[model samples]
Structures are given as structure tokens and as C-alpha cells.
Target chain A: MALSTHTTTTGFLLPSIHSAPPFFTQQPNPTTQSIASEQWIRLILSYARHRRLFTLRVEDAETAGNDWDEVLRNERINRRVLPSYLSAIIASMAAKNVAAYEPPKQNRSALLYWRLPEEWAEVLHEWAISTGQLNTILTFYDITDPPIESPLTNIPLPLLRKAITILAKTNRAQLIGVADGEGVRFFAGSK
Target chain B: MHRRGVGLAAFDRQEQSKRSFAELSSALSQSQVDHLHSQLSQFRTALAHFASTHRDSIKNDPSFRHAFQQMCSSIGVDPLAGPRKGGWWAEMLGLSDWQYELGVQVVDVCVSTRERNGGLIEMSELLRLVSRLRGVMGGVITEDDVIRSIKTLQPLGAGYQVVDIGGCTMIRSVVKELDEDQTVILAVAQLNGGRIVEDQLIQQKGWTRDRARAALENMLLRDGLCWLDDQDEEFGRSYWVPSAMQWDI
Candidate 1:
């Protein structure tokens, strides 16, 4: 087969010889798989951060099919192959501790913040400064709720919980349990 | 006498040894001794088995390698970086829980956003906001976000009436401000404009055809709103036109 070449804006040169058929396939050869998977991981993290995408509905994709061509071009997000191909990438990332998996629920979508733990920690710090809620109780939901940018909203719930747990350990935030007449909710606020 | 002394010494030594043996025997029952020995052996076997099994499973089972993939699929979540702790963690996330038992419901036509974008709030924001807050904070503009975006130009004058028809809530006003009557009639009139139909209005605002028509007629009498000439006694069969318009002020 005739070989081709492409260069990303980052100046990385990729040989396009084998990119014709297998590149589009969900399961590629080992080398191609690794490259594609890494690229996909990097792409999702960077793209999602740029958009600050916290929630994605299936219908949103349908709408975006016309509008957000750049995002829609990424084969990684094809919901048609979602439960299989896309899920595997998430699993791999979780296994490597490179990201978190927040299991999706109805009305709730998975958020993957490419921002690091330290970034999230810094955001929490800034939130403390702005809200003056130091040494106070805040719910897990409160941290992710608006009024400021939070990794919790942009990341999946499972990962967000992990981030909170990490913050608690670092003495960055305090998680308190308060009960009104109903049940208890976990409140995490900066210390 | 010397020979007898030697035999007695030997017997005394033998008795001492026998007492020591008896004490050891009494300390442990037969079953207990057996159980201890067996448990030690079992522990060794279990450790060996666990180590070898984990090693083998890692190599053999692709499912074990990609278990997190399955969890994400079942959970309807996009995956990210974190620890993979299998089924228990999955359950903790409530991935398989009833949060979605009713299934993912997409509002076919999002009304809340439309209300804000269409500037319908200038026409009706205050009245609705006040009515909602009636049981609470005295109709203050306490609602901060999108509700404010849809706020009406003026508060509904005190001369408004709230009517409940067949368990559906409708508001009526004479002096000014679009009340429940105008809103329902507007909804009915707007139905032909691809805004809403009878069932949708009924479902969304809890207005039956009877209630919607009464509200429509009241608006017509006031020369404020209009509806299609096609009339019906039943609320569902009739259509309406709401005169949500601007006057030459």
C-alpha cells in the first residue's frame, strides 16, 4: 500500500501507511491500539477541559453532530461503540490511576476533568478565599455546584468522591455529616 | 537396704516425669490438638493457592483485565483515571441502582429554556414567581438564577384570582397582569404555533380543557386574548389563541 504522512499541530509526525483501515477500527493491532488509545486519552482530556463539559446526554451528541464537528470527528466518542470500545479506554485509564471513573446514573453524566489533583486542590483553595467558608460544612454536591469552576462537576462522581477523599486526607477540606429530619449527606468544605 | 534405696530413687524419678506428661496432656484436648495442626497446614495451602490463582487469572482471563470496562458499560458512565476496585465499588457508585429505573428521560421540548429565551418573563414572570413563593417568602425575588431571567415586568396586581378546576390550578386576573387564565389560554392559543397542544398543556401546567377554556373566555371578554372559533364543551376538543401582545405605550 502507498504510504502517507500527517503532522499534528504539535509538530509530531505520524506515518499514515497503516492508518487507512485499522485506524478507524475499534480494535487495532497492538502497536496501533496503544497509539490510538493514548491519543484518544489525551484528546478527550484536553478537549473536554477546553469545553468544560460536565454533562453529556445522548441527544446532545445528536445535536452536536451538526455543530461540533471537531469533537464529533473523534471516533472515541461514538456512542454506537460506547458500551464496548469507549468503556475499555475508561477502564484502562482507571487501572493506570491516570483518571477516575464516575459511574453514570440517569440525569447524571460522567465528567472527566483533565485538570490534575493539584489543580482541583487549588480550586478548592480559591473557593475558600471567595466564599469565606473556612472551617465550615459543605456537601459533596456543594463543591461541584456552580458559582465557581469545580473539577467535581467536570469529572465523574466516583472520581470526584476520590478527589474529596484526597482533599480530606490533605486537610484541605473537612467532610461533615449533618442530618435534618431526613437522611444524612456528606458535606465537604475547605478547612 | 542399699538395693531398696536405689529402686525407690528410680521410681521417684519416673513419677516426676509422669506428672509432667500428665500436665501437658491435660492442657490440650485431643480434638483441639488435631485442629491446631490441621489449621497450620490449611493456612500454608491457602496462601500458596491464592498467590498462584491471582497470577494465573491475571494472565488467563481477559475479563479480569477489562472488568472496569464492563462496569462502565453497565453503569452508563464515561471512564476516567482512578483505582479499579471491581463490583463492590461499582455498587457504591450506585451505577446499577434505581436512579435510572424510570430510564433516562429527555424532555422532548425544553420549556424552561424557551421561556427565558422568548422573553415571556416580561409578560408573566412576576405573577408566576409570586404564586410559587406564596407559601414561602412573600413573593420576594429570592430566586437567583434562571427564574430571574424569566421574571415578569411587573408583579401581578393584588386583584388576581387563583382558581382550581377539577384538581388543576388556574389563575385569573381582571385589572392587569397575565394570570392563570391568560396563561392557559395563551398555552392553548400557542398550541398551533408549535408551542404546546392540549395534552402537553394538561400534563405540564395541570390545565384541563374546561379550565383552559374558562381562562380563554375570560381573556376574550377582556378583549385581551383570542382563540379559534371551533368550540367545544370539553376542554381537550377546543383550541385557543392567546393575545400576548405589546400595546402602543
Candidate 2:
């Protein structure tokens, strides 16, 4: 009974049930399976958010090559989540708006939205105002992968775009299409 | 003639004495009846006072509570009856409605989850579920409370009974009675982590191959206590007990 939780490199504490063998297996009963799926959804979102992972591919998750993919399989217990069960869990997550299909039509992969675009927009605006980067043009890469310590560092481009779009809707920020990439110009006092 | 008159006087005297004796006996019996009535009332008052003072203990302690109910029944007092029904014992005990509400919730939890658990649930698991169902409004429901509620459910013949197997208390819905063979299989399965194989039973319990097979099949088909997996190449056919599978989650 040495069941224990694993902490991610980014300091996200995975729940103890993550390592349990049965957690990977699909429950045969509908009610219990639904609960298991809900738990799986919660775990995926939290893990993705903690490690700032924006996308989760079924292949990547099911494979043991990636360190972060340990959640999908418990090797010590020799239990690997079936692909069908994983797809069902992802489908349910998509239904709940917690995740979206990567290509919109294909269910092969999903972009986890632990924090919705609206929430990310608020976080971005707050960061800009506090850091005095308002009223200046910042490239998408600069905003997502800033050299200095910032919460928005390493944000996925698609999620970043969504967040910027939310700010654009509120007239707090404007998007600039450059020859190479896109840039966002935040307006001071336009909150 | 003088002798005849004397005899008549004596007969009259005897008749008068007999009448006086009858009156004396009646008066004596009436006083005894009054004394007995006073004693009964006094005893009832004392019992009521005792119940009120020890209400908490009686509610929390299983054995004590059982004894208290027995005592009440012996005196023709129903402690489980509604308080507003003017039963002195019920009012003093103040556990009737509480027990009744818990009983209703227990039945709900048990009935709703019966399909998954096959009408058999570990006592601790049942308590956890009942507590979750009741939420904040239900306060605390102890093991004793569950037992007491199950007791109240006995009259309904809902097949609610507590079974002790391998030192763990399991509540089995008597709707489907488990015969001796099924009971033995369940006990064996509990020891093997909610799973049992025909070979294990035959080897350990010294049962013949036919007897083990019959018992296992009966449990799977009739009692719904097991799930069969013909996919097990090693075991041939493996029976798994869902209730005994303790998922930490």
C-alpha cells in the first residue's frame, strides 16, 4: 500500500490516485466510470496548467517516453490507460469546454484550457500594467517567452492569441500583424 | 320448638359473619390494587428521567442503545414511536425522528447504489456515502446510528441485515438471500482481494471441483456478487467481487 503522489518539475502535486493502477483502467459500470472520467479531466487540466502545457496529444500521453506522460500510465502497477478510454475522457472534457480539439475537426489532440481566454486576458493585462509595458508594442514571442521573470512566460501561441483577442474585444489591447509574426500593443488606462 | 328457634338464630349469625368477611376481603384487595398502580407510575417516571439524562450515551453506544430499546419494549413502551404521539419514553429519549430521518437516507443511498454494489456494501463505505448524501445538514451519522436505523428497517422485510465476514462488517440487502455456498464463496473472495478462482477454493477449502464450480456459478448468476472473466488464460474463469475491490478513490 505504498501509494504516493508524484510532484511535477513545476511543483504541481499530483494526487495519490494518479499512481493507483485502477485509476488507469476504465470502470465497467457507467456511474463509476463517469466519476473516473471526471477525475481524469480534473487531473489533466491541473497537470497541464501547472507545467504550462497547452496541448495534450493522445500519442504523447500514452507513450512512456515523456516524463510528464507518467499520468497516463502507472508502470509500477503495469496498468496503461486504453486509447479508447482516453479519447472518451478527452471528448467529455471538450464537451465541458475545459478543452478543445486541436484541429477543430480531428479528435487526435486537444489544447487544455485550465484558465479560459477571459481569465488569461485579465492576467495578461494585469502583468502589462504592473510591469509598465503598457503603450508599447511587444511581439507574441516576447510576451509568451519573456526574458525576465513573468507568469506569462512560455504560454502557447494559440492560447496567447486567444487571450490577446479577448483583450482586443475589450479595447484594452490591439494586435499588429508584422512581416514575420504578430505583436500586441497594450493601451494604458483602457481597462 | 325452642331448639328450632336457637338453630335459626345461629344460622342467621353465621350468615352475618360470612357477609362481613366478604366486605373485609374486598377492601383489602382494593388497597392492594391502588398500591400496584402507584408503583407502576413511579417506575415509569424514573425510567423516563433516566432516559432523558442518558440520551447521548444511549444514542452513541450500540450495545447500550440495544439494551435500552429492549428495556422499553419489556415495559410496553415503544421508544421508536413518534414523540408527538404522547409516548413518554419517545419524548424523553428524543431519538425517534433523528433515527427515522437517518433510516430514510440510508435506504435511499442503499437503493440507489444497489446496482453497482449488488446490494452488499462494506459498513465504512456505506457510512461514507450516507454522510456525503446527507451533506452539512445531516450532521454526524455514527455506526451506531446506522445500526439503529437498519433495526428500524427490519419490519419492512426489505432484506436489510448486517453481516460480519473476515472481521469486517458488511451490510447485505436481504432482498436476495445468500445461501451457505454463496456465503462461503464470498468469504473466500474477501480473503483473496475481491477475486476467487475455482482452483484456489478447491485447493484451500478441500472442496470437490464440481462443488466449487456450482457455487461460483450460483454467486455470479443469482447473487450478482461477481463478474466473470473468461479472458484469464491462466485461471480459465475468474470471478471478481466488485464490493470487495477497495479502490482508494
State the lDDT of candidate 2 residue by residue for B126-202, as single tens digits.
78778887674343777888998898777567889888876778888746677777777777777766768999889
Native contacts retained, all candidates in order: 0.00, 0.00
For model 1, residues A40-146, the per-residue Cα lDDT tens digits are 56655655666665433334334445322343233322222233445566556555545554453332233455766666756656665566766666655566675
True contacts kept of 1: 0.00
Candidate 1 chain B — worst ten consecutive residues by lDDT sum? Answer: B101-110
TM-score of each: 0.31, 0.59
List ranges where model 1 is wrong by over 4 Å: A1-22, A54-83, A104-113, A146-157, A180-191, B1-249
Give the true-structure RMSD of model 1.
Answer: 29.2
Q: Could you give candidate 1's per-residue lDDT for residues B74-183 as a string of tens digits?
A: 75643322343333222333222111211111011112212211222222333333434333343332223223222221132223333332333333333346665555
